[model samples]
Target: MRKKTTIEILLFSLIICMVLSAVEGSVPILPLDQVKAGMKGKGRSVFQGNRIEEFDVEIIGVLKNVEPKKSIILARLKGGILEEAGVISGMSGSPVYVDGKLIGAVAYSLGTFVKEPIAGITPIGEMMSISEKRKKGPVFSPQVPVKKHLTLDELFMLNKDFFLSKAVFHSEGRALKPLSIPLVFSGFSSYAFEQSRSFFSNLGFNP
Candidate 1:
């Protein structure tokens, strides 16, 4: 009886360790160095009505030094309505996993009306580094002076830095820009919304 009880305790301990290790490995990060071209992965995001959906990702290649000490993973995304809609504006920062390990997030999109849902992924390592920096200190402060009346061009010029950045790539006279975010307006008249639509679009918001 003593021997049997000892054996049972050992088995229980082994099972507990296995469970813990499995939990730890479930969301492991795949390092950028190990990532290669032609890797296939799946990304999760909400396409409609808060329902999380999965999409397929195929790695094209890695863009080295896209920014100083940063890299972007180029990939072609498919599945769901991606082929019809292309990369949706708000799909940025969706986690992409390759070989059951996270590689990066969808952050940049190919030019408008592209034939495919090609995207640029900001690597997990780079994102983690940015998060670490944010924890160190305050990284941004908004101090823009608001003017009561300004023309569309003047408004754009005032926020030019916020509206534009260095393009990720240029193809066929189109620059890879950040995916525009969709904005919903409530309690506004149709005329007001229409009037401001172009202004918001220039600032990367699709109203």
Candidate 2:
């Protein structure tokens, strides 16, 4: 949800208050792990949109609406504390672990206004899918493969470089084909990408 809206900010404040108030005298739970669907857990969050401190909450459900988007988690206030800390802004990516297992991350914040403490969460598996991709940067081959042994203008998808996992290496290579004789035009030319063909035509080039 867009964070610029005023209503969204207010909704976050309410949830933060709910969680913080519910956990009174109770330790605020914020553990880290891989979150999955249907995992029950809790979190502590502070809502900055309004005056509120860390609050606690219980997760109900995990949802996936679109790929690459944060997961949605369904939850409600436990009916204890102030009822503000249940869910709040800046709580996205909050870790949800159940039975010592990570189930997901916090995703829901105030988008459209609501009455009670309610929010969605992102699954920990999806979060891992993202975190796992961060490491060692992109893999680059030191040496170019021999010509005739490679294909022209081929595309390759970069694989994840896991830091904690054991190293796994594959002996694979790619071929780079020439897009022009001077090679200078290729540097800034449309052929640099798939849409270049159309871009060049827009530049008055015939096919």
> Against the true structure, whose TM-score is highest?
1
| TM-score versus the correct structure, for each prediction | 0.64, 0.38
For model 1, state the Cα shift of residue 73 in Å.
0.4
> Which portions of model 1 show Cα errors greater than 4 Å?
1-26, 139-168, 171-174, 185-207
- lDDT per residue for candidate 2 within 1-207, as digits (tens), equals 122222323432353344333323333333323333344545544444454343345654444442344334455534433264433344544454456554544554433333345655545444454443442334323243222333221211122111111111111121111111111233433434443344222222223
Which regions in candidate 2 have their CA more than 4 angstroms from the true location? 1-39, 47-56, 68-71, 79-86, 136-207
* RMSD (CA, Å), each prediction: 17.1, 19.1
User: Candidate 1 lDDT, tens digit per residue, 1-207?
Assistant: 334333323433353344233223447899899889999999999998999999999998888886667788888999998989888789966889998899987878888778579988878877666445544644222233223333555545543442324455654465567776677878767976786678667656678
On a 0 to 100 scale, what is the lDDT of residue 192 in model 2?
40
| Prediction 2 global C-alpha lDDT | 0.37
The CA lDDT at 97 in model 1 is: 94
TM-score of 2: 0.38
